[model samples]
Target chain A: MISIKDLSKVYGDNVVYSHFNLDIEEGNVLCILGESGCGKSTLLNILAGLTPCEGDIPKLRTAYVFQEPRLVPNLTVLGNLRLIGADEDAARQMLASVGLDGLASRYPRSLSGGQAQRVALCRAFLFPADLMLLDEPFSSLDLRLKISVMQVFKRLRENKRITALFVTHDVDEALCLADRIVVLGSGGIAGDFSNTPSEKYGGNSPLRERLFALLSGN
Target chain B: MKKYLAENAYNLAASLLAVVAMWLVWIIAYAAVGNDYLVPSFWGTAEEFFSLFAQAFFWQAFAYTLLRTAAAFLISFALGLVAAALGVAFAPFSRFLRPIIAVCRTLPTMAVLLLILVWTSPKTAPIVVTVLVLFPVIYSQLTSSISGVGGELAEMARAYRLTARQKLSKIYLPQIAPVTVAQTGANLSFGIKLTISAEVMAHTYTALGGLMSEAQTYYNLPRLAALTLCAIFAGLIIELIFRLISRYAFAWQRRAEA
Candidate 1:
């Protein structure tokens, strides 16, 4: 239900994206995979209308999770969610779903990095949005934390069926969370593939090998 | 609870020790000077302090000075907060107002007091001078704290689409509150002291400073010492009250640290 065409972004003699185009279907989890500085986050910001860019984006209410949790440091976890209009009960329930149930009254400074990211996830899920944009949301997580958070994302998507555009560089992260993965090269889409985790093979899977090779610049 | 009581008891002991040390120095000086006009004995000042408690005039003067302090503080604090908010919200306006605020901050208190005395009524001079002296303190503290709010957090607030009220109460207010409380607590005593100094010069009626001036004219060193102690106590009390408020207001912060 979302499409971008001829989107361009420039910052003082540096061009990040030139005539880039992308499309995301309704209720699909699309992960835009890219290396650092390849405009994965810029694309998300353009979609969120946070960055000034030449593009046409759908006027949809979108919730965003930055690379940092960006939780208000002075507010309790519940208060941060409430800042986005979540009632105590709904916020508590979502916090529970994300394994942060009893941390509602805790301030952001007291939380571990992984727990804080989970709170950000809970925030995005708690706020009913037409589309959720996550920018490298799991880049800081360890393997165990990453798996746990990815599971939470999977569960939230399964339950809500919300359209989400996830921006990240990790190939494994995209494979775990995305229904369709689009690899973002320097200027635009370089590799786009349909991903179904249950049906995809292990070890020598052609799709996985291709993705790994593309990421390693083979 | 035991620990809390122990801490209070320790504080009381320390204060008593300090008071004893002060009395020892006072006695030594009194011995050396041997003149009540120049250096009053500790017992003489103590007598004056007790006598002043029963005198209605002394209480009236004390009340008058305290009321003036409260008025000056409220006016300065309110206007300072408003100015700081305006400065933070509008950059061009802040730039326009910066030199004026800087003048207030850097100008000598006595000079500002003299200017106010010349331009304003003596009755209002102390309050006006207090504001001129203290407003910059509150303004700078607030503006700096507000500016310290990170851009990333602002972006987060926008992404969440928080209402203006929500953004303030939830984010900006909380972020600045600790610093505001600290600045207010530290400056309040100084503001009150400046108010008294202005009052002495302005000849504001029924104020502690006017009483002090009268004592000085009469060469009543014991009464002057008693009055000075009273002023110090009043300042201590104000600082204590603000400390209590800061403690209660930031109890959540304490909890997080714990």
Candidate 2:
């Protein structure tokens, strides 16, 4: 479990967050859902200790997948995977899992956007970390690629039960991927919900409607 | 296949045209001067070139000069890599090195050669001068490229807990290889030229520059021109070899570009 308290972040004249606090349970997919510039990615960066913030964050080994793939352009797909200590067989298997088989020797520049992102995802998964951070990873992906990528994440999550903090503005992405959803607004938590089976399958979940209202500022 | 052949033929024609132009200029100049000592006939210079090729002393001189240049170049290359690494790892040290790099960049190669000759023996002076002339160029190139390795990749490396060696070989080298290849391509010829120039100034015993200087003293214009042409041929051959090696070394980049 990770706990953050009294987080305050400011950049010159712009105030990003003030007295922000969050708690995430272990082995849970917690999505920080928000609109543009709602401090979602900033929160992730703060948690990762990349950006300056006054807060108490739990000491967790973290793997981050940025909005861009951020791959070494000169390295082949498998080479990038091996950087994180994945061996040849494991790297190849991971690539195949993301539908990128036979691309082990291809450089990042040679890969399509979707394929590159999948490589980034594989890199994140291959790293030995207690927590994973994703920043708008599927935002630039097409619908089909997004779904396939989501499935990749789903399969990995099911297999490893790795704790994750996924940040995004997409409502459907949060609905499909997160075990718990935390909506951020006005530099603080606006709505927080934990999903249950019936809430996902039953006629119309109040949680979904409430989340929509909260997101739209109704 | 036809297009490729046509391209090759055109290239050959262009090269021949260039040679013909040079020959015409040499003939015209020789005709105007009417003195073999001042302006050798193209045929006379050509004959000297062939004769020089047959001489063991010429090959020995060429080989010795090449060996010295390669030694100096390798030293410069190694020191430059270390300097760049130190600069990246420590900002204060990098700041300390900037002025020295600037001086090396701006100082005349001849002046540096003379200064080096005062301390080093004539035999080693050329090597020292070559390093001085080339170190800043190679160091600056590597430092800038090393610094430009993105923070994102660094962070990624950290997240993965990559060992220092892993980070260097996997991330730093891959990122820096292109710029390094480019700088090496441009500087290799310059390094060779500087080495020969330094050899001449230092009065090195077994070098093309020494032979050229000797020819100049005796007014052996044809022999001088022949040696000069040999130097040009050496530079061209070295450059071509470097290009081929770089293409092979960074083949992944070519693939990505393709």
Candidate 3:
């Protein structure tokens, strides 16, 4: 289990998190749903060790999928994967898994928005990391592309049994991918719910209604 | 292929038109002055320019001057790159360098040349002065370019835990190469002009500035104009060479943009 205990983070006059505590089970996909400025990204950054926090945070190798693909423009798709120590065959295999096959030699400029994000997903899975920290990785995609890319992400995450903390403001995204969903509010986690197989597929289940109410209240 | 050829032809014509316009201005100025000593006729300067190609001493001086400019440029480029890299790595060092760069930028060229000539040999003074003047410019350019390497990309690299070598080769270098190459062309051209001015101030013999000084003393207006023209031509040639190199070296950048 990855644990964050008594995590305190401040930025100038703004107090983002104070003595926040959370425990994540191994191989569990925890989706953090929150409105803007609710410290969702800060929590992920703390977990990824990108932000300094005063707490006992576990040291684990992390793979990050940012809002933007963040691929090196000059590097080919495979080359970007290779940058983080992915071997040729593993990178190629991972690319194929994300439906980016035959684009190993293509640069990021050539890839469409959805395609680039898929490569980013491929890169995250290819890395030998204990945890994956995704910061609204699909926020920029249109609905059609978002669904397509989410499907790709779901397939890869299940195949790898990735322990990921997905941060998003989209309730549908949280329901579809998250094994457990936590809604971050001004105070702390305002709502927590387990996403069973039945609730995961339901379009407007009681759980979804509850989450929407919790989010709107926060 | 046809479009490429047509584009090249148009560029060539545009360049020629500019040259012709300059020649016309020079002709007009010469006619108005009607004094060979002040503004030599275009043909007179052209004759002297062509005659310079036949002189062994002129060629030797030309070669020496070119060598000095090139040496100054290379040294300044290397030093600027190292300093910029250091500045990027350490914030305090960057702060420290800010004042030094300001001093270099604002130093009086003639005073610095005089001080350098007293401290070093005349032959070396011009190169030293040129380096001092050019280093800060190059350093500023490089610092901005290196810093401009996207913050997002850097964060991604750090999150991935890429090794230092991998980060440098895969991220820093590629991101900065195209901009650096483009700026280098302008920097080298400016370096040549500075070197020549320093050489004249230092009274360095066996150099283009020395030849210009000799021509001025003899009141050979045509030769002086020819020497000035030669320096301009050298600057143009250096700029063109570097521009071509940048185009060839970073073709992928263009392709990506396209």
Candidate 4:
């Protein structure tokens, strides 16, 4: 249960947002979809309380997956999860979910890009936060590794029933991972779509045509 | 082979040129003066040097001086590392100690010497001065090494909620060791010069400084030259020892650079 009203962020002479609004219901996976530099991450940081912007956000425990892994370089894969108060078993399970089961003792520098980002994801899941924020956490991943991480996120979503706001420039990623998708354009919140992946249609169904038409005001 | 030689060519050349220039100067000056009094002939100094290598007393002095230097290094290193660790973990307390460290750093060696000479025995005077002069250098190096570890990793450690001791050994310690080891050569050399100089002044019986002093008093120019050259050789040995340490203790650095 999170809500934002009339949120705006300005940096020097640049205006990232003016009166931007978002409402996240419980157990919903909402993604802020946008092109690069559309301030999706700035909005996520604001919600994480890592940045100050004009808005009143509901106070709740939150975990964020930054664009980079942001895992502690010195810590082992398990250790990062331990930071979020995960116990030995929960940390192991979360790492296993991300296919990092055997990497518990390895440091961030020792991990591959995808593995490190997955460790960051495991950290977020392990935190037991009511709200999760992901800012293009999978951007650096290749197509093969990206699918595995997406599956891990899907499992996390199914289990936690936690409200989440993931930001990404890729529409396909937004489609596959989100329960509801909000497209942020030059004006912000250009289109909001209810995404439902079922037995009938895979959520990974391409929305390129519809989204392009929608964004272009066609 | 080419890359290896290319990398070290400058150092090798410079070292060779320095030896050649020193040899040339000695030969020309000895011939021109035609006197062993002004500056002993290179052959005379070399003979003294060769002769001293077989002398038990010379070896004993050399051994004692080296042992004291090693002892001073170890003691000062531990003190410096601990103080730095405390400083990094608790900045407020460190800030409180900052002025004290500054006073130690800036206080005159003569002042330290004159002050400590009052209490310590003549034999211990040089060791005490070495520790005092070296303590500041080492402590200051540790302080910077601690600070140079920077805030990002520290915050990461905090988020991990590491225990006080865990934070020190894991996050803080490794990051600074390479830097601390780097400061060792400069600090050791600093300590060596001061300690040996003090030894010369205090006339300690069991020191290389005492040997130099004895040479000066007896007008044994060859012995003085020989001892001076021995000190230089000892210094180069020290540098080589630390270079080997740098290779191992800072393996992470070697990896990154490689």
User: Which residue ranges in model 4 land beyond 4 Å of their true spot?
Assistant: A1-64, A70-173, A181-218, B1-14, B32-34, B86-95, B249-251, B254-258
Which residue pairs come into collision in candidate 1?
A: none
Error of 4 at B226 (Å): 2.6
lDDT of 2 by residue, B91-206 (tens): 99999999999988888878877877888787798888888888998898898899999988887677566789988988898778866765675676777788788878888888
Candidate 2 docking quality: incorrect, acceptable, medium or high = medium
lDDT of 1 by residue, A123-214 (tens): 99988788899998988888778777777777777767788999888777777778899987765777999987432213455777788888
TM-score, one value per model: 0.91, 0.90, 0.94, 0.71
Off by over 4 Å in 3: A197-202, B1-16, B255-258
**What's the distance in Å from true for residue B6, model 2?**
6.4
Q: Give the TM-score of candidate 4.
A: 0.71
lDDT of each: 0.83, 0.83, 0.88, 0.77
Place model 4 in a CAPRI quality band.
Answer: incorrect
Candidate 1 local lDDT, residue A23: 85
Q: What is every candidate's C-alpha DockQ against the true complex, given to 2 decimals? A: 0.54, 0.53, 0.54, 0.20
For model 1, residues B60-165, the per-residue Cα lDDT tens digits are 9888887888788888888887888889899998998899988988888777777778888767888888888888888888888988889899888888778888
What lDDT score goes with residue B71 in model 2?
87
For A1-218, candidate 4 gives per-residue lDDT tens digits of 57888888999999998987788988888988877888988887677666688866666667777777877655567877775578999899877766779989776777778888788877877776778888898888888788777877787767677778899877677777788988888877788889863322134344656766665666
lDDT of 3 at B58: 93
Give the winner by DockQ: 1 or 2: 1
